[model samples]
Structure formats: C-alpha cells, structure tokens
Target chain A: MAEVRVENVSRSFGAHKALDDVSIAFPDGGFYALLGPSGSGKTTLLRQIAGFDFPDSGRIVIDGKGVERVPVEKRRIGMVFQNYALFPNMSVTDNVAFGLSVRGVSRAEIAGEVQRALDLVQLGGLGERRPHQLSGGQRQRVALARAIVIRPQVLLLDEPLSALDKALRVDMQVELKRIQREVGITTIFVTHDQEEALTMSDRIGILREGRLVQEGSPEEIYDHPVSEFAATFLGDANILRGEATETGIRLGDGTEIATRLNSMVRMTGKVSCAVRPERITILPASAAASTTGNRLAGRVSKRIFAGDSSTYFVERDGQTIKVLVQNAGQIPFDEGQDIVLTWSPESTVLIRT
Target chain B: MTSAQAARKGIRPALPLLAPAYLWLTVAIFLPLSAMAFFSFMTDLPMAGREWSLTLKNYAAFFSTSLYLTLLWSSLRLGLEVTAWCLVIGFPAAYVLAKVLKGRAREAIFLLVILPFWSNGLVRIFSWAMVLREGGILDTALNAVLPFTVSIDLMYSYPAVIIGLVHSYVPYMVLTCYLTLQAIDDSLIEAARSLGASRRQVLRRLILPLAMPGIVAGAVLIFVPVVGSFMEPRILGGRTGTFYGTVIEDQFVAVFNWPLGAALSFILLAVVLLILAASAPILRRAQQ
Candidate 1:
C-alpha cells in the first residue's frame, strides 16, 4: 500500500550501538524481510520503522511522509508481535476491530470489516471466541487479521511465525503470503530464520553488527553473497579462503579451483569462494583424474543420509568440504573412501572477504 | 512398592500429609462459621442452667432496627469510598513500579511500599493520630513551615477514617496490580499503539481490561476487611466511627447481645458474598 524508506538511521543503547547508519528502501506492496542473527539490529530496524522506538538520528518516511515527529498511535501502522498479542479480554472479533474502533469507525462498518478481515484470514464465524480459546495457529491468524483490519499503509511483523510448530508454521507462512498479497500492503517482516526469509519475502535485507550487509532478492543474495558472513549466515556455504589469481582463488595446497569472479571482488589479493553443498557432485577418485572444472580430491570423512538426499563430508588438505548428492540408484559414497568433488564455476560465489 | 502399585495406592501418604492442614482450616474457619450461623438463630447463649431456643428473633431484630440498617449503609459507603481512593492512588503507583522503575530500584521501592505492613496495624493507626490530631506532628510541622500559624486537626473525622483505611489497604492494591501489570507483555502495549490506539485508549481498552483481575482482587481484599473493620475506625474516626462493625462490636461487648452480634456479622458476610458473586463473571474473564 505504501513505500517505507529508512535513511541513515543510527540508534544506540548506552555504549552499544543497536543500529548504525543503516538505510533500506522497502518498495510499495512488496513483502520485504529483515533477516539477521540475534543482536544484529534487524528487529531494532523494524521497531524504528513501526515508530515504537525512534532512531537517534535518521529519517523514517512512510508513504512519502516523514514520521520522525509522529507517534505510533498517529502513524497508522499495523504490527504483529512474535507472541501474537491479541487482546485476551476481547473476543476475536473485537481484537480484529480494535484498530477501527479506536479510530471511531461506525459499529456497523466495524462489524462488517471485522468479519471480512476474519474471512480473509480464513477464520470467519469464530469472532465470538476469546483469544484463550483459539489455538496457537488460530491466534497467529487473529493477530494478522487484527493488524490488517484497519488497512494500515505499512504492516510490520516481528518473527510472527516463530511461535508455531513446524507444520503449523509452514501452513501459516503460505496463509500469511496469501493475505499480504490480497491486501497488497507493504509488509516488512523481521525474522532470523533463513528459510522463512528466503521463501516468504520479495526482497531480503541481511543485517550484521548494526549495518545492512546485503540487500537483494533471495536468489541474488544466496547465489552472489558479497561477504563471507552473508554467504555463511544466509545458508550453509563451504568457504574456501585462498589467494586470488587471474581466473579464481588458489587454495594453500596449490589447488586452483577456478570460479567466476563477481564484480564485487578484484583479482589482486586474497579472497574466498563459497560453494553450496548441494551444488557439488561426488565421484570416486579413480573415475575423476581426467575431469576438469573446479575439482577437489578428498576422503569422505562422514556421510549423512536423509532418505531422498545424502550429505558427504569430504576432507581435503586438512579442511572439510560438504557435498550433497541426491539419492537415485547410484552407489552411495562410503566414509573413509577417496572421493572427487566437482562444482561448476557459476555455482561458486566469489566472496569479497 | 512398585511404581504401578504405588500409583494405584495414591491415598497412602497423600491423605496423611494433607490431614493437618485440612484439620487446622476446619477448626480455624469452618467450625467457627457454623457456630456463628447457629448462634445467629439462638435466642441466648446455651448455658446449662438457662433455657434457650432456636429463634428468628435476631434476624427479625436486624430487619427492624433502623439504627443497624443506617450503620450498615454507612459501612458500605465507607468501604466504597476507601476502595475508590486506594485504587486512585495505588494504580498509578503500581504502574510506575511495574513499568517505569527498573533493576535494583524497583525491588527496593517495592519493599518500601510494603514496609508498613511489616509493623503492627494497630500501632500504625495510632501513629496516624500523632500526625492528624491538633498540636500533633502535622500541626507543628505545618506551623513551623507556614508564615501564618494554622490548626491541623484532621482527627475524629470521616476523612480521617478514609485516610487510615486507605493507608492500610493501598498496599494490597499496589501489590496485586503490580503483579498483573508486570506480567502484561510489553509488546501488547506496543501492538496497541501501532494499531493507532492512543495512550489513553491503550490504558482504557488494553491495560485496564488486562489488569482487571488484580484490581478486582485488591478491591475484594480491601473492601471486605474495611467493611468489617472496627479497630481502624475506632482509633482514627473517634466518635464519628460508629459503623456497622463498631455497632456489632458494641452488641458483643457493651450491649452483651451475642445473638444480635452474630446476626449482624452474618448480614455483613452475606453482603460480602453478594458483592463477590456480582463481580465473579468479570473477574473470571480477566483471569482467562
């Protein structure tokens, strides 16, 4: 519904800076996720946007209007807390209608709108029940319905699906995306779960140590992480730190694993390349001496089978590289056996660090 | 014993473990209440030499006595006034203690609020006389500070009774409300504000409704005791403190009317029960 832009925001608690000169522009009607580890200032950024906490020196603009002077009550934002803080004293209907009721909307309109919101959440006909009567997933839906009922320009969700169990969380994630799509509200969600951020958001911003480390589409960031921290944090990446050469970086053992150098990296100094486990294929060393294209020889130290796919830990030059192989009819690699690992140049991400 | 057999034989140790407490409560509470109810129906104490009978005369006497009714009304009004004042003063104090104060300061301040309850209640009431009576600490302190000398005689008055009662009961309100208010998630308030509920609206719709159980518990704890309080009014209110409780005290001690006292106490019990029953639904919802 509206674009939210946070510009040059810096906030501190005592000596510790929670957010440091962080800037990100959330485009209109796009579901953007702020992803970071704990104490990385992702939640702090979300709270600043919601007007719950003000930045020490920054500008937060919502719908092209600067909101530094406006309080949360007058800012017309909607928020879903991690706990789904529905008004326990109110029925589900009343909880959904709370924003409208506070704004002095008519009773008839509030009832209709509340019902519509509940229906949008697929929780219609349960408005008379109190919050305690609802299950955890139901409470989550109610929290979402309550937030969007007032048609807020920006919806803020702070780890909303973190409380639900795995199955329920997966189900609600789809439900949440559907509701956000239907409403077309500019939603900014704060979550530390990498899979949830990657699967849910249109754009993902990764925060580290109070700074925005990377902001891009999930695929872009995953496939072309600019820093070692981003590559390792966003997903599991086997980082190969070595000296840069004309084509790629050479490991300490003189194994030149050639990879495409992204624009972020200059081939003049030491660099690192992150190769995902699933991107590499494992082959017996006897069958791999003649092959080229980023190959490594190692003994399989550990093999983890998970029915459909298997993860093989390959030890090469005192370092372990993980290779994931889909389970078809091929013979599984045994632990302690010599294996050859190979991945294409495009799958390897050249890290700036 | 095997675990299965031990489970099947659940009452082996549990009953004996709980017997002492149940016995004490029965002797200390239930038996006396039953005796009081019985006494309310008797014409006189059942002395072996005297002939006594179960009668409705005491109940009838309460219905007929205009003086008793007026005193009961006075006591009810006193309870209401004291409860209101305690809430007005206590809720904000509780809010500050629970929400505003932090770390070691909150614990220290909370202890300070409850410090008076550590001392004897009667001593505390009598101490107020020194502050409220003419030529007392208040009079001396005020006269010393003011340019014009002034009399500070607040003793032997209705407000004096309210002050003492409020002073005695305010901690109950604060303690209960602090627990509930502190338990409230901070996110709920933030969520309400983000949804465009102003500070006042947040307090009215979210905070107050969520804290109702504590408020109700405090009101009940204060109102019940204050309604039956004879010592506080006697010490602080002086002659103007002839409440229903004081009148009942007169029946037992001054008038030597045991049956009438029992009846009055029973009527007050009924009133307390009625009040609790009236608010049970609201309190139940709040607890949920």
Candidate 2:
C-alpha cells in the first residue's frame, strides 16, 4: 500500500537521453500503466522506480522515503518480467515461495503461505510441476503469485501479458486487474500495448521520446488528448491543419470544423483539430439533407465490414477521413457514394500544435 | 499407416544414417574391450613361444595386495581434489566471460582462456615441472621478492600432481560452464533481486542449479581422465606420483605384466562407471 513518486528523473546513455526530467507521483493502491512505444523510455522509467537502473539525476521516493540509491533487494519491490522468469530449477510452489523463503520465513509457514498464494492465483493444485510443464498463462499466474507472496510495498510488471496469445492475454488482463484489486498493492505496469493500458490501468501516463506527453485516467485521456501525437497514438483521430479562427480551423477547401475545446491555444494562427473516428456518423448523400453540428460532405472511398462494426474511409479534399459505425442489419454505403460526416462539437478536440 | 508399418518407416531412414557410427564404435571400442577382458582372465600374455592359461589370479592379486588397494584410493582422492580445484577456479571465470563481459571482448577473452588446450598436454604438464621443481621458477621468483633465502621445492609431491592436472583440465570446466551460463537469461537475476534475494542467494538458488549440467559434464570429463592418467603424474609428480595409473603403466612398460595391467584397467573402468551411475540422476535433472 505504498505510493511511488518519481521526481525530476533524468537518465542518459552516452549523449542520447533515455529519460529527461520526468516527474510523476503515483497515488497509493492505484494501478498505473506507463504506456509508450519502443524506445520511448517507459521501461527506463520503470527500471528507475524498481531500482534496477539508477537515474543519473533526481530522486525516487517510495512510501515517502527517497530510495534512488537503494538496491533492488533492499527496496522491497516485487516484479513480474515479460517472460515471467520463473526459475526453471524450481517447481511451481517453490517459485511462489522464493520471495518469502529469501526473507527467512519458517518452513511450515512458507508451505502454507505458498499454498495460499497459489490458491489466490487460482493455481491450487499445481505445486510440484516445473515452470516448463505449465502453459504460458499458468506461468504468468505463478509469476504474479510469486511477486505478491512477500507482500512487497510496490509491485512492478514489465509487459506482463505480452508473451501470451490474444485470447489468453485478454483473460490474463482481467485476472491481473482482479488480483491487484484484491491485494490493493501500488502496482506500476509498463507496456507498449495501448489496449492493455487502457483496459487495465486506473491511471495512464503516455510517454513519447523520453518525456511524459500526457497523464490522466483512460476516460479523461481518450476524451481529451492535448497533442497531435497523443490524439493519433492513443486512438484513431482525424487531424486537420489549417488557419485558426473564432470558430475553429478553416481547412484548405474552406471547410470550418468547429472545436469545443478552447483553454490553451492561439487566437489567430495556424492550428490543428482532432476528431475521433467513432464520434463521426456517416450517411449517404441522398439521405443526408440536414443542417446540424459540424457537417462535412465527402465520397466514401472504402468500407470495411467487421462483424459488429464497420469502418468507412471517406475522401474529402485529398485526405482520407475514417469513421467507425456500428453495424445494423443494412448494407454499408457503397464505394463512390457521396456521404455526409457529422459529429457534435464536443467530439472535436482542438490541438495547439 | 498402421502402427507397425509406421514404426518400420521411421527406422528405415534412420538405420542407414546411424549404421556407420555404430559400426565404428563396435570395431574400435567393443572389440578392444572384449580383448582386454579376455586378457584379464589370463595368467600371462599369449606371446610367441610362451605358455599361457586362463586364471583369476590377477584379480586376486589386486584384492590381496594392500599397496594396490591403497594406491587406488589415493588415485580416486587425487581425481576428486583436482576436479574440486578446477571447479573452484573455473566457474567464476566462466561466469565473468559469459555474463560480465560483452561483445568482442568476451569472444577474445574466452579464446584466451581456451588457448592452452591448443598446445600439447604433455608439454604443458612438463612446463609445470619447471615451475614446481626445486630452485625452479617459483623458488627463484619467491627468493627475488624476499629478504631471506627460500627453498620452495614442490616437485615430486601430491600437490604438484593436482596442480598440473588442474592446469590441464580447467579449460574443460570453463568451456562447458560458459556454454550453459551464457544461455541463462539476464532477466532471471533481476527477477530474483526484485523478489528481495541477495546476491549470494541468487547465485545459490538460481545460477548454480541452472548451470549444474555444465558443471557435471566438466567434472566427468576431468575426473575420468585424471583417474586413469599416467603421463601427468609421471611428468610432474616424479617419485611421489606412484599412483594406481603409474603402477598400470609399469606392468606394460617396466614390469611385463600385461594380464595384471588389463585387470587393473578393468577395475578402474568399473570405478569410473560407478561414479557416473551415482551422478546420472543429478545430471538428468540439470538437463531438464
């Protein structure tokens, strides 16, 4: 039940800075996800928090104690690696008991606690089996059980479900969330998968090029992304670069898209606007004869039929605009059919850059 | 296909490929072993114009003679000591080469560790004689650094034999251990540390067990050969190196007791087999 606060942490490899002046405070008992692309320094920041690697500058405070210089063994952090890293020489029970055994727990108590941990992970009857004998998902659960056995102040997971297949990954994600809620440990998970981050974490910090570009709850971030990178990277967003006006941005084709966000932007300069794909509704031009909020007319270039939903790619002024619509029992708008795209002004996000 | 036909089909391609190697082993190993067994049961070598007969006398002689039994124990202890020293020195060297060093530096240093194996074993052992003999390199070096005269005579001693054997076989330990140690994932160590395992705990609980196969392989390679070794003991041990191996050598080279020597050799082979069988389960677990 400890909170981890990374303060002004900066680390560099030679002249290339991997993490630069990043500061973030994780609330106690919160499931936080450090989401980023490869080489974006999410793993580096996680390592700094875990004490696997030290930051060249700045302090790391865990549970109100500055421990940037402390080694991992003394920091009392449990970690589940990407590959699980279950000790091959040990059986499933032994792997789970490792942390407690290292802390000099009694044998009778270790056996009981190990069994309880295994039961907690729902691996009740698999004590004697080696790590190689278990399935990928089973190994992941054992890893989780092992990390929580000693009841560390904080738990770190480095791409915990990345090695599992799609179905198992989803299953494990739900299971992971349930276990973390049960333990109520301050857990920090690092991953490159955006869906995993969005679905599993209470709070997410999106990083880009060694800097924290955005940090908020999933709903907060999804509904309002400040930068163009966050807008496109977190989810599908249509971006239009044009001249800023009192209403919004005027496109090259003289189409003015209204943006509802207004706090931090220039009054009269070039600006960009972002609109999510799912927020827009597409209708055939023959049936689209209404004046509403933020309307645009374009020809449908392509339509993809996924089982429950279909994405329509519409071409408007040399740009392809993507719109996701739920599939009703009707044929989608055909190719070369003129369509009108409409979304409320609340769905439109104004980007400062 | 039916089960019998499928089994036949699987064997058809493999039999031809496996025949040459098995045939070579039968000719080179089994035939000689059979011949040695036959000679061990004989009272004398069936040389030209010599009387010979089958007897259990050589085996009886080995059991009845205390010198032979004592020397056998001595040779076994020598093998154990040498294997222990090799492991003590070699495992850390292997770990450094495999984990600590990286890139081309690892490759170059690993080659340097294995470079001695490229030279002749006899020459290497004899070179140790130069270092261990009275008033030799070691004595001279120690004397030059001290204010008093020093008599560092280590030649013709049991420790000299162990030193020479360890020098000749430590590379085997380093090579085998390096292969397995390098395959250990770096993340396992970090995972252990994250679970609050100290450095010694991680090494004992994770690394030593994981590298057990390589350690066993290196032990078998060094111990089996050192148990039957005559040259290393003779070259470096001189007079005090009168081990069971040297006694076996004497039967063929000096004593003219071929049947007895073959019987002794068979007994040593039995001891080596027993040691291997004792450690087989451990080796199997390490491999898994």
Tell me, by TM-score, which candidate is best.
2
TM-score of 2: 0.96
Q: For residues A1-353, write the lDDT of model 1, one tens digit per residue.
A: 89999999999999999999998999999999999999999999888888878999989999999996688898878899999988877889989999999999999999999999999999998989999999999999999999999999999999999999999999999999999998999999999999999999999999999999999999999998988999999999999989988888899889887887567536668888999999998888888466667888899999998999988889989999988888897988788998788888888877777
lDDT score, candidate 2, position A77 = 90
Off by over 4 Å in 2: A265-268, A286-290, B1-8, B279-288
Worst 10 residues of 2 chain A by lDDT: A283-292
Would candidate 2 be rated incorrect, acceptable, medium or high by CAPRI criteria? medium
In candidate 2, position A280 carries an lDDT of: 96
lDDT (C-alpha) at residue B73 in model 2: 93
In candidate 2, residue A73 scores what lDDT? Answer: 92
Best by DockQ: 2
**Tens digits of per-residue lDDT for model 2, A17-109:** 999999999999999999999999999999999899999999999999999999999998989999999998899998999998989999999
Worst 10 residues of 1 chain B by lDDT: B279-288
What are the candidates' interface root-mean-square deviations? 1.8, 1.7
Could you report the DockQ of all the candidates, in the order they appear?
Answer: 0.67, 0.69
- Residues B1-288, candidate 1, lDDT per residue (tens digit)? 898998998886788889999999999999998998998899998878977899999988878869888888999999999999999999999999999999999989999899989999989999999899988999999999999989969999888899999999999999999999999988889888988988999999999988988998899999999999999899899999889999889888999888989999999999889988987987786655
DockQ of 1: 0.67
